[model samples]
Target chain A: MNKLKNTFYPLTAPKLFITDKLMRLLLMGAASTSVLVVCLIFLFLFKEAGPFAFKPGLGKLLDSQWIPVSFQQERFGVGSLLSGSALVTALAMLVTVPISVLVAIYIAEIARPGEREFLKPFIEILASIPSVVLGFFGLLVVAPLVKATFGLSTGLTALTGALLLSLMAIPTIISLSEDALVSVPYALKNASLALGASQLQTIFRVTLPAALPGIVAAVMLGIGRVIGETMAVLMVTGNAAILTASPLSSVRTMTATIAAEMGEVPFGSIHYQALFWIGIILLVITFALNIVAQRVLKKYGMMK
Target chain B: MNNTADKFILLSLRLITYAIVLVVGYILFDIIRNGFSALNWQFVSSFPRRSGAAGGIFPAIVGTFYLVVGTIAVSLPLGVGGAIYLAEYAEQNRFNSLIRLAIITLAGVPSIVFGLFGLGIFVLFFGFGPSILAGSLTLACMVLPTIIVASEESLRAVPKGFRDASLALGATKWEMIRTNVLPYSLSGMITGAILGIGRAAGETAPILLTVAAFYLPRLPKSVFDQVMALPYHLYILATQHPEAERIRHMQYGTALILLLLVLGLSLGAILLRTHSRKKFRW
Candidate 1:
């Protein structure tokens, strides 16, 4: 121990010390900078939202009215905002998770060697495409197709947003679940097969069970992506800011509401603060999902 | 219980996987056919908003380039510097762990949140007023986590022998990293930059809040001048006025160009990463 210390410890120790102290400074700067930015946003948002909270607006936040035009009758509700975001995200995850899991299964077990080679990188390429471009494609291609088939005049709707978001979430689900699936020991699979368990049975009972933690993690990650998606949802979801269960109806998600309105909403007003509150909601939801993901992974013996 | 059923299930799995591949391929092909073939010299060189049939994306392209350059300039140093500090200097402790958690949290923070933050701080507070600088700085913060993670992986990939040999040669810790560690890790560092650029190019929200001028500024003379980016231009053209035939065409043309840029960069990074892994047998 003494000899090792002598080797590392130096006479002058490079007085312009670049190691320990420099690292602390750099980390502190990066961490504080990130936290500070988010904190400031919340602070500013609440400052603006206070007036709306105290003034007793025309309607409660859960009330359906959103007319802010009349000076004597101002009303804003975020219930639809929350529901619209939730409904779209839920639909997206529903579509994305199964498809992603199947792909993960195929890659992890079913694909022939040559097929795996071709398919893996192709999926990666799909993932690397940008969200804006995805939104554009949804607008021009997917939206029009839906409108034509569904007897709608235009493409922008909850269904369009859900479809686009599903595409966005697939890569995350597939990738993380693939990691989890692969982490299932080969010995386990071999043992199951050796016991005369059919391939499908082995996968469902052993491989998948062993990989359940990872699968859950992937689902949570996809939830994060779907819930937080903005531009594509904004462009394709018709921005109607209404409550509807019908997938074809034009609606606005919480994310879309913030993005579409922030440009026109006067700063430091009730509406502006409400948008920040929406942001706060978004941050909380995603953060909770991430924590849940961590917990699920931990329970399943999956390492962080 | 039945061999036929087992074979059918296996075959169906294969078929489903193939279907996924074909769908993705068709999407790419359609993008190329509809979006790519529209690219022209006039489209590449002319400024935006010719009103009727003469719209082009010269300024949007320039705006993209400027945003990318500025973002890279800001993010690369800070990200790689932070990564080096984490990997090289920081001891495995609570504080370091907390910072790691912060980075992971930062990574999870949505792009729109980053946009809101950017809007509040850079645009409104500092009075940068939704300029390119604000857009670029916001993007810089957004991509920083990616760069840090990628570079840290690269730094970790360096063989321990290299470090031991440098130490035996009486080299200081900084000298060891500067001369040997960095050179060996340059390929990975470059790969991270490429990935970061691809991401920044596709980002729409931050640009929407920050720069994304509704009308093209004939051309930007300085960083402060508001100008349209390709994604922003595409958003406007897609959402606000699809009625304009010329603007509609410009949207497809712009989308094609932006897709090409992002796809090309992503492919290049993947290739570089693959090649490096092969070269190093990593």
Candidate 2:
């Protein structure tokens, strides 16, 4: 028996050991690819963007007018695009935050069990609807409605984009804030009720305060999404790169500028490089927002 | 008076919730109402004529199918492998923490930025030249975080006793995971991958710069060739086409198809997840 076992075991054990080590190495390499890709994204964006710093110079980005196609000269100001993004994102948050928070409250606190089950997945379906379709809806349906309602010559305005963006932002904020509200320990609610607090009072005074950090994180993440959103804004907002604070006016965002011009711009030209520079700006802003949100979640132990 | 105020507030919240639901319902209703008329067998099977104002959307449909195939090919193995490493092997350490951070950051990076990265790396550096290969690679990166997170969650859900039993029976670690862990977690992983593919299918920004063609009415002969995707096609039809107003029916038709594709995949994922939970109770 010992001799048979020795012969059988020696042949397979070493082979299995070798394969196990190899597989682990392969998986580790696969896991590390994300890190590598992140590094490459940073490198490539800066490499392509580096040329603009020398020719048009970084200072040119501050100019308020963005006219890449012109007869005599080109202007690569990113200020207008920045303001456009800010205007749309601000308006979208204004609309989304209140509605999402209330809906989240209803889903987590007020709904019956069966209703919660149905509502959660229903909202997820809303989340799953493609942004491009949303953009299409905005273009054909919402844009016309806006044009008629506001007495504007055109339906395509910053407000039109804002409304569509609000639709997109709603799912994200509701889901995350719902998770926050749900995670608030039941014991706290029980204690609040035990103190003779009304259901509304308990939710507002106890649950909302406890889940504030997660809700804030959720809102920040939603804003990150709005700021980075491209196609919907590109379609709904009239692609005019002019600085304006009015929601009723046509404006172009940083994302829209890149998507619109990258197709037509000559490769390796300053215009091309400027688009990459804008990409870098977008990368930095979204990265900072994500890191901050992650930090908040981690600090509050709400990451799960 | 306080009770009356509380009652009023709760009622207002309920009304607002229903209104949000109504708005979403209206959007879907409007699309189906308008788009159903334009969708036909001829429209689905034929190629476009007159700058997409009059032809069928066969080429765009085929292009999106190819993209979904290619994205699944590239992302699934890497994402699942990454998940296995994180869930089964890695210890608590700074390096692992950094990898987690990278995954989170990757998830939050804007889709347009992904387009730029794909343009710079695959198109420019690797010389794929804005083809399906480049676009698939770009999308794989974008959706990797979702797959990894979901897969790891499922992997962790398998009972520790199973792993211990396999080990006690003299099975190698890899053998144990292969036979015991992966089988159970596969449905969850596929659900995550399907969701990722859905996102890839709907994405226009990343493909806009990497792979999508403006008016390619023919099917791509190879991965190197650019093709017309449904989302990008819808964008062109709705906004960029010179006869955008005249082609309103076509725009709605494309939107309907794309919406059905994405939402159908998501619904499948949700259903599969529920079914798996029922089947794999332990």
Please report the candidate that would top TM-score against the real structure: 2
Which parts of model 2 are misplaced by more than 4 Å? none
TM-score of 1: 0.92
B-chain TM-score for every candidate: 0.94, 0.98
Candidate DockQ values, in order, are: 0.50, 0.85
* Residue pairs in collision within model 2: B48-B55, B49-B55
Worst 10 residues of 1 chain B by lDDT: B46-55
Which 10 consecutive positions of candidate 2 chain A have the poorest summed lDDT? A120-129
lDDT of 2 by residue, B1-282 (tens): 998998899899989888888888898898888889999999999999987999799999999999999999999999999999999999999989989989989999999999999999999999999899999999999999999999999999999999999999998889998999999999999999999999999999999999999998788999999999999999999888999988889999999999889989998999999999999999
| Top-lDDT structure, candidate number | 2
Summarize candidate 2's per-residue lDDT along A193-238 as a digit string, tens digits. 9999999989999999999999999999999999999999999999
lDDT of 1 by residue, B64-124 (tens): 8999998998888878887877777778888677667667676777888878878878888
Docking class of 1: medium
lDDT of each: 0.80, 0.93
Score residue A121 of candidate 1 by CA lDDT.
82
Point out the worst 10-residue segment of candidate 2 chain B by lDDT: B16-25
